[model samples]
Target: MIPALFDRRLIARRRRRAVAAAVPGSDFLVEHVAADLADRLAAVTRRFGTAAAIGGPTDALARTVTASGRAERVIRADVFAAGPAGDHPVDVVIDDERLPFADGSLDLAVSGLALQWVDDLPGALVQIRRALRPDGLFVATFVGGDSLTELRAALLAAESERKGGASPRVAPFVDVRDLGGLMQRAGFALPVTDVDRVTLRYATPFHLMRDLQAMGASNPLRERARGLTPPSLLARAAEIYAETAADPDGRVRASLTLVSLSGWVPHESQQKPLKPGSARTRLADALGAVEHKGE
Candidate 1:
């Protein structure tokens, strides 16, 4: 069996704490992703009878879907309740690894900044595909690619210098290239994947760390170093971060690569790729060029 990469319990605890604290501006990414999801849903002309918003840190996703009038009903599901909900309350507490929905029940499923934490991402995607009705659409965005590269570098260098060794501080993120294949592996038809890069500037490295903690996005890797990070290590990391990642304005840049994935449940009516060697027109004829034969 494949081992878990993240500590689920710790993730839940951190998320719950964030919700309870209600840190101001901590959910900026959630809001940004919610807006992006809304825009994507708006592009679709057809309305969905039922939809599920999975793993949203806030009710932002559900609210956005509801407000779009694209989905008649939106079921909000998360690992932990993100405090009292807004227009749509938390319908089910769920682990991304296991969904509770019945097969072929949902017309749409949307998630924002959540699937990256799932241990079995492919399995979770399979479950999502199974839960969707024929031709049902799935759209999601997650942190991926070279996210937090500067922080990872700074932490590693600092820890190595101060403690003689370094441990994993930032969680590993998926590369954009692999997402489309994952969608195909999960049996989704017409799968599409793209990346959206967002760069945030911070006055200092410590500020960035505090913001991550507020967002419950701190390291949750199972192999992460135990116990609190040393103050001296942290200080050194801050120094290194400023020195290496700072711009002319003296603020450091942090990169966030949001990988967007969209696919549809297979249906007989959906378009399919033409079989190999089935084309009526030759490529040479279409291109107005002669075909060459190799000896």
Candidate 2:
């Protein structure tokens, strides 16, 4: 369900191909993102009328919303993915960063375990804002920094030891602080952003990679494409990952940090008036205030 990274369609397609992947580490990252956003969206669903998820569908979430018989489903899925089989019809059509709706079209826009794959973050945010109605809500959560400290450090060390050069493997992720400003700049109002860190225990580093693959969040790095990962290098990386982040019970702990951001589409329905003194202040009060200011 990934869109183009600066129009990197090939790279984006690779993400979806992770369906059969068994790498535990990558699987953990993908699942981490989906599960993180799932919990967040459930808690904050009431603020909107009909919520629309732009990326891939969350089976549990779609079912919960429809079963409640309160919310409407707007699933934007792959047309080729064995037909639509959800509780409700997939309503709107949206790519990774672009929506078919006009400005201020929907009440709420949400995403989970997505956005990190896209290179044009600001562009995507602008499109999302355009799809919201005035005073509409936007909430999105994605993987961010400190997500895989152990895996990153271990991989770098292993690569340096084996290949002498370690070309930044963690794939850059956004920070919560920068994301809030993007919302405001995109014409969203009162934008707020925060992050949560979820720590999970795993018996082996290999298991973590397998989970990441299952979640469809494997690395699709463009410049790092090589035919083989070299069995020896992977083994060394696993050893380092195990040694550096081992727990008391011999389980490796991975920190999945999620950045949650929310913004409101500017609304003309503001309760505040244009001029407060024009209605609330009396002539005597105004004159007294003027005298006090002069004094």
Candidate 3:
């Protein structure tokens, strides 16, 4: 097996903490992505009778899917054993890497602001694809490579300047360009990927860090530094961030790039690409142009 890149236990603990937090942290991003996913699903001509959302902070996606009336039922699953019960309740708590659904059982699958933390993304995608029936749809959004660019740069610069080196503070995210290929590799047909860049302004880098902690999005990389980050390092990083990333208003900018991926299971009813040299009409004839052959 591939060595784990994220500490799953730590991730689960942080997630539980985020769930219990009094403040609403990072739900805005999750809600935005969930609404976008729901809109995409609404646009589809086909209706899904069953759907599931895997490992998201809120049940927004599941509720949207259910409210669309396209799906008869929707379920939410996460690694954490329990969370705040809401209108859209979680039905299961299983590791996303090991989905419990049976093959060909679902008509749709959606996730919001999740899956990026999974150690084996490709494997998880394959499991999702297998769970979907033929012609079933899959849509998801996760943090992309461009997420937290300012913070990453500031951290690196600060650590290099003070400690003569840097440790992994930000988790590596998937690139949008690579997602389509991953979907195809996982047996998804007509795979598509796009990015939604959301930028927010913060008063200071400390505020940004606080939000990350509240959202349970703090560094959970297996190789992350074991000891407490020196207060001086954080102070220097905040200074660097303010100097380099702050706007004229004196607020620092942070960006989250949500990479949306969509695909469907292949079925006989779905459209297929035409074979080469199978055109019904000649392009020259249609365009009223002469065709010249190679001499």
Candidate 4:
């Protein structure tokens, strides 16, 4: 990914964390998932000895590589802070989607926790596929299905109990089953996709929401609510979440589903139709023989 994008994103995430640092919310969940994603990428780095790594400041993902004590000769790139592509000694550069490398150039590619933030997931996947040489592989994980289930349920229930309808929409997630197909459609071979739902209990909805903001996962969607939420509405929403979303022991449960996918660039797959009109047998001769036998 382009270093400029990474730099901008880190700056933006920092700003977002600063803005909502006081209000503990869903950002916390995003942070946890992001960290997990980073760690996953770092593992790939360590194992494959990929030339470079890319990520945010608290990049335990890349640090996972260093922490493993493998001590390979690898380079790291901030992608966001990178002034020129490949200028950094690191072979992998993890920024947002805008990959800086040329097509079919990378040996291994990974992205953690950030693919969910992209508007054009398919396009990005295609680009990633193109960046790899034949048989080169890409692995990534993103937020999907049933995430923030409790928050969504509580808010919807509260809205129903209060206004007899829905409030502003909360975040939405992609289902895992659908994303798997997307890999095949993008021309990736042996595509694999699966989901992991990490459930956590929160003391309060307020705390849940606080964590959300810290991860720079605020509602960036254009169709978000226009007007401010009324105090009564928010109070009722929190009440409903606390009252209804409690687990057996009463900690409200929230889940973050990480959908992981892997795909390989087709190495030797058939891409063309069979040579045209190779058969020379005549249909008329066969019909004549059948007719004679009937006689």
My TM-score estimates for the predictions, one after another, are 0.94, 0.76, 0.95, 0.67
What would the per-residue lDDT of candidate 1 be over residues 1-295, giving only the tens digit for each residue?
Answer: 8679999999988988877778889999999999999889889988999999998678899899999999889898988764555422488988778899999999999999898898888899999999999989999999999999999999999989987888999998988898889999999999999889999999999999999998888999999999988798899999999999999999999999999999999999899999999999999999999999898
Candidate 1 segments exceeding 4 Å error: 82-88, 290-295
lDDT of 2 by residue, 96-211 (tens): 65557676667877676677767779888988888787877776778887798888888889999988888665667877678777887898887778878888788998877766
Candidate 3 achieves a global lDDT of 0.87
Show the lowest summed lDDT stretch of 10 residues, model 1. Answer: 80-89
Best by lDDT: 1
Model 2 residue 254 CA deviation (Å) reads 1.1
Q: lDDT, candidate 3, residue 135?
A: 96
| Candidate 3 structure, TM-score to reference | 0.95
How do these models rank on TM-score, best leading? 3, 1, 2, 4
What digit string (tens of lDDT, one per residue) describes model 4 on residues 169-262?
Answer: 5656667878878898888887878777788788888777666656555554445456776778778878888887787776787777888888
Clashes of each: 0, 18, 0, 27
Using TM-score as the measure, name the better of candidate 2 and candidate 3. Answer: 3
Candidate 4 lowest-lDDT run of ten: 81-90
Q: Quickly count the clashes in candidate 1.
A: 0
Model 3: per-residue lDDT, tens digit, 177-221? Answer: 888889999999999898888899999999999888877889999
